[model samples]
Target: MPSKSSARLAALTVAAACSAATTLVLVSPAHAAAVRIHDVQGTTRTSPYAGQKVTDVAGIVTGVRTYGSSKGFWIQDPNPDDDPATSEGVFVFTSSTPKVGLGDSVTVSGTVSEFVPGGTTSGNQSVTEITKPTVTVLSSGNAVPAATVIDARSVPAAYAPAGDPAANNSVNGLPLQPSTYALDHYESLEGMNVQVADTRVVTATDPYTELWVTVKPRENASRRGGTVYGSYDAQNTGRLQIQSLGRTADFPVANVGDVLEGTTAGPLDYNQFGGYTLVANQLGTLRSAGLERESTEKQKNGELAVATYNVENLDPSDATFEAHASAIVNNLKSPDIVSLEEIQDNNGATDDGTVAADVTVNKLIDAIVAAGGPRYDWRSIDPADDTDGGEPGGNIRQVFLFNPERVSFTDRAGGDATTAVGVQRLRGKAALTVSPGRIDPADTAWKSSRKPLVGEFVFRGRTVIVIANHFNSKGGDQGLTSHYQPPVRSSETQRHQQATLVNAFVKDVLDTQKNADVIALGDINDFEFSGTAQILEGDGELWSAIKSLPRSERYTYDYQGNQQVLDQILVSPSIRRGCDFEYDSVHINSEFHDQISDHDPQVLRFHP
Candidate 1:
């Protein structure tokens, strides 16, 4: 049964579709009769009437956003066309506070334009909008248009179809296939009011008052209620990012497993950071799922527990030292050897030729001891100032934190920032030329990126070689919602080269001693299934320990809404062939609101 407001809104919609009488009279003599909102938003991503002036475009204002840099109101025509490829709603960019209120019937005169968020070179789809609008309120207090429902059935299973080769493999020129692909399905509803009911949160509420929810709750569901990104082809299409038009202080603080338990209605928008986002006008109440952090079992006396944690450019003055200390002590259970990445210089980003990190490493060490953990000592090669690519002047590099009581660091001094480490036969066993030395530091593959730090250690009676790495990030890659189909990942070229160098270095150690115990662990900055990982596991010389876990539990980092693997631990055949190792992706920070770091730590236990 439709309420009175619904019935009135339906009638108004039919009338608007049947007649453009109100707009035709106000149209200038130079132009033809006024066009509807759908006509301005053509079947393609770009509007056909772009850069042309449109007069007397009529619709009922559904939302009024008085804040933000792009202040505007969303207007939806009550009368909609039969084509699902066209949207009935469009944003009127007022450039100031909108005078029209919600439910006010208005006619606007403006220039039709396609606004590409974050500039045109960003590879994002353009948003169709009416800019510099002149509004004329025809009437007040009319019912707003009904919102289109989006659910599991409405969105397609496939991500997108193959793009036309003539258009350089970009999907921008193709017509919308609303029922065939999820990207097209969302594109068909761009700028229109849509609703999602009983959505499950895949990404926790971030610091910017944004979160992500999935319409399909059961689609590749992980044990912790996150969408598992196991492969590149199986992109979880039901995931949608959410931002609020209401007060930021009142927005809900939610975790990954929480549920938005009612109808959340909003206008679908296309942006640069995230592709298709729902800017919610009516946000749903949060329902907690009681998600908790994870902890791993302690290692035995004979077993060596090695771990990797990216401290996210940690310095001495940061307030998260105590939290990071607690995470290392409590969540990770204080592994025997921890490879810590992103340890900044003394002053941390103050560009004054400062390249040392003793202060930062000592601060973290002191904090760990204060948190009731073992007295850990650190070793690292200080990178040249501003040479490694991270926060400028931060001089971020890898540091090894070892518990002297459990393991002994084999320190053969003479390692510097540019000196490359080599393998040698020391007393009929494989040994490093210089402990805590950089691997192929002069190679171009490591240009402006952190080089791998190789160190030698003796756990019980056998020697172990460990390499710590932090490869180049995916900064310039096109997003999933990009206009180009099969988004290009330009960042892989350097990472592939980086992986090749590290793999060759491991081969050198094995060539010296066939059964040499070698473990390479840190933030690989690529997927376990990616080519980068395959290169690291070249010809079965090394095997990734992350594969030991089930497909659903392999993620150590969460981005957008997909929980994927970025950090990894790969060991030689000597360690992996035995199949006696234990691996755990400790979930301490990534899934929480008050996170100390953006990545989860990974630990591996093996007998050396």
Candidate 2:
């Protein structure tokens, strides 16, 4: 089925592989002389002899991927060529159980091909491979190539290739310079043995049998465990993913700031999920950086504890309610008031028109009570039809759950799901015209988004206006593994608008009462140091409560190897100046694979 162009190219490729570099050998008219493994895999991402046949390519087998669609083995020359612009190793795609062993010295003939993971439409990097290989066992138990040190100096300062839509494949047709860009550096070492040493763990081990570490420290490093993710900077360059797919044991769970004191020897791999990975056979010592899952302490007398949690779209029919309730009771220490986001409708993803989450909230409250927690009363406004964005027909919205045993919801007249709550000054205090009312629901910023829900809660003879929010997610933003150098964040524009509206509401409250105990808390869906969070903390009207903790310990979420903050509780200036606040980013989730929710609930205890 090979076409004329492909067949001719394959014939020439076979001839090149047939020729030996420094040995007398039989030369076939149909075959080019066997070439070095480096000749086929030039410095460029795409091979020089792609679509052509290559034969007699001799090397020692370095790795084997005998499972999944990528069933193949990697081979590398024991002694590399002098030119650094060429790779001495290449993957031979068998597409089935490979006959080669780990240390077999073999000669192979196959068609050189470039395989784009996720297809060409994804715009990810393509893997150069030898397909449909014919192998000749030359020897067995041969020595493998030494692993190249992957220290700070080995990695370039730059993070990604310069181009649009992520990976800039081929660098706009320019020749690759492996020493300049980090992408080029990984490309040059593709399929070769590599080692990383004296690294810090950024992401914990996930169910996929992988973890992330930074071989070199990056800019804006947090004090203890977190990594401050700022604008499109090259901060993630030193980070590398480590997939222990070939390991005989399960990968250990690690928190951020953990140290790996020893060397991890593995072959460099580039795949679809992450960019460059070290497929280590044995991971080094994981030094505990004194970071672990923390249970927040209970509130003190006169201090009302308020918490916010994104339940990851909790529904009445979902099976995670019990676990979530248990976490709230045992880990979060039963806050007096809790802001719950992503509360779906009763049917949950059925696409029906039923938008009411009364059944859903009741079940969660009942579960909490059954799990040895407080008797809770919840409040929220249902979205119009399917206007809210989430799982289709799920109508995920925000809800406020207050412990009636300690606090009460002050509901006023004239409020509905479609009506916006009016802010009024009542007796030298800010009061919502209607309790559990929607905030500017008709605004375009909240179009197809979960509108902010404002509730007035009376605790210990004092009232506080709590605004719960579930802003637009960071789904559309390009990932850190993106190929584009310093990836672009396209979701900030809308989130900025959302933050502005929320900040305006807080300012209105402050105008009514300079010391108004207004706490805007929920899933902000951005980091504490992000522009969105900064905008919400405008002119000292409201301060992010997470900032009360030491920078080294301020994190509620973990992603891509970095302990981060996404859920925050922003309070008024009076609350921060009073300095009687205890904020805890409950570490019950995010780092564990068996988590009921992807996020950890945050509790802020203060005198209101």
Candidate 3:
């Protein structure tokens, strides 16, 4: 509930906007009959009357976006039709800034259009719009329509469209069940007045002045302040985006678990970024979730700990060394051997011909020692130029950092760039001829990506084979917010093959040594329920260590309002059979604005 002062503030703001709107009256002939905004918007992402000339489209101006190349005002029909499937509001593109006022009831004449925000090359969907208009102010001071309540109880529990969640499946064209599916629920409310109360913030406010929240907290949610993104099969459907349309200052900077305590009333919209967004102006007061940073348990003697971390492109230019060291040492507990992804070459993002990471690794190792961690030794093969995907010239690739005081790295001869290491069955046990060798480097699955780097390590006089990897990222995949009925995921094709090749290699090692004590870990860039994970865990030969934890607790990253897993560790059957392992996601990063990296490192502690 708003205080009298706050309520007075809201009234004053609305009054001020109406006063401004009253001053910008324009007169035009009302020769043609008026058309409702919903008729022009139709029921689809594109307007049914696009490219056609429409006259006398009348609505109250809801907002005026004066900045940006796509300057426009959103207009809504005060007397909306009884169709829940159609949008009552539409954006009127004025291209050049126009003298428009909020709450001004005006009659407009323009060519109906379907305008893409970033244009066609960007693959962004189009917005229903009225362009090249003739405007006439019909009236002023008319009350805005009441907001539709969209609280947690109002949202459907089921997210993602039913049937085939992927694009072009047999059931992709099935009719939407708006009452049950969240995608349909949001789509039905697109471009309409919608509001949510007492919502819990799900993601940190991003650079785009947008943040996600769950209107109603999921049941039995931990005091942790965030909700599980669940698996790919069961995405968090309760999430909603609140985007600031009037001012960036209006949107608060928040972390996962923070609460937006007041009501946010605005027009619902569909865009390229996220599926549905509430374009807001008068947002509610924020409530603190009281979440704190956490660190994992320390690794003790005889308990070998292995971990994976994505350093978020650390380089000499970025002054994140000590902070990263603190996270690795104090937070992640300084595992005996850690597989590091995205270790950049010297000079970082500079596209010079330099491929050496000696200085970069040296600085990080020095930072670790300075931060009371072990003096670590590292191993890696820098990628060819910018062939490895990441910041240009960063030469990002998988690297191994081992605490020599606790473990020894096996560095035999004959391993280099572009050389693939084959598994040898020596005395019925899997062994690599050369240590720190790439797996199937020449294979197409690893083209233009970081190839798996396998190495042997002796911990407490027992040898174990570990493979480090960073698979191709999900860059070009259409977002969940796509206007398409079911979103496309074209990025998975390559990853599926990459998984197959990796799985085959793992099987070879298992067949040679049934209890190989093998561990394959890094940022796989796919969900646990995804096909990529399925292939990697083929025939129960390898098991994802993160799965060892409760389903609700398995997350290494936070996106939107859902805590999800993007980093994972898969160990061989021998390790799973023993059941002596314990895994921790180490919530040192993510869920916070000030963190060392974007990803939370995962650790698996066990005796091999």
Number of the predicted model whose TM-score against the real structure is largest? 1
TM-score of 1: 0.94
Estimate the TM-score of every prediction. Answer: 0.94, 0.83, 0.90
Model 2: weakest 10-residue lDDT segment is 15-24
lDDT at 389 for candidate 3?
72
Error of 1 at 3 (Å): 50
lDDT of candidate 2 over 1-608, digit per residue (tens): 24434543342222112222222222332233296688888867778889999878878888877665566777898878787767788888776667777787777787898876544544456677888777766666777777888887877877656663333432523456677777777778888878898788777676566778887676446665446454445345677888764643656666667877798877787765566788875578878787656688988878899999999878877899899998889888888999999999988877779989899999999999999999798888888888978877789999899889889999887667788887898887889988879888888899878899999999888888899999888865655654444555677888899999999988988888887889998988888878999899998888888877876567777777666788999998888898888888887777554567778889999888
Ordering by TM-score: 1, 3, 2
> In lDDT terms, how accurate is model 1?
0.87
Which residue ranges in model 1 land beyond 4 Å of their true spot?
A: 1-33
Can you give the lDDT of residue 90 in candidate 1? 92
Q: How far does residue 34 in candidate 2 sit from its true spot (Å)?
A: 5.2
Q: Report clashes for each candidate as comma-separated counts.
A: 2, 14, 1
Top model by lDDT, which number?
A: 1
How big is the positional error of residue 519 in model 3, measured in Å on the Cα after superposition? 0.6
Q: Tens digits of per-residue lDDT for model 1 on 1-608?
A: 24434543342222101111122122222232279999998898888999998987888888877765567788998999999999999988775667878898888888887887756666777888888777777777898888899999999999987777898678988999999999999988988888999898988888777888999999888899888888889889999998878999988899898999998997887776678888898989899999999999899998999999999989888999988998899989999999999999999878899999999999998999999999898899999778889888789999999999999999998899999999999888999999989999999999999999999999888999999999999977888888888888999999999999999999999999999999999999999999999999999888899999899888988788898999999999999987889999999877777778889999999888
Q: When superposed on Cα atoms, how far off is each prediction in RMSD?
A: 7.5, 7.3, 6.7
**Looking at model 1, which ten-residue stretch has the lowest summed lDDT?**
13-22
Question: What local lDDT score does residue 503 receive in model 3, on the 0 to 100 scale?
Answer: 89
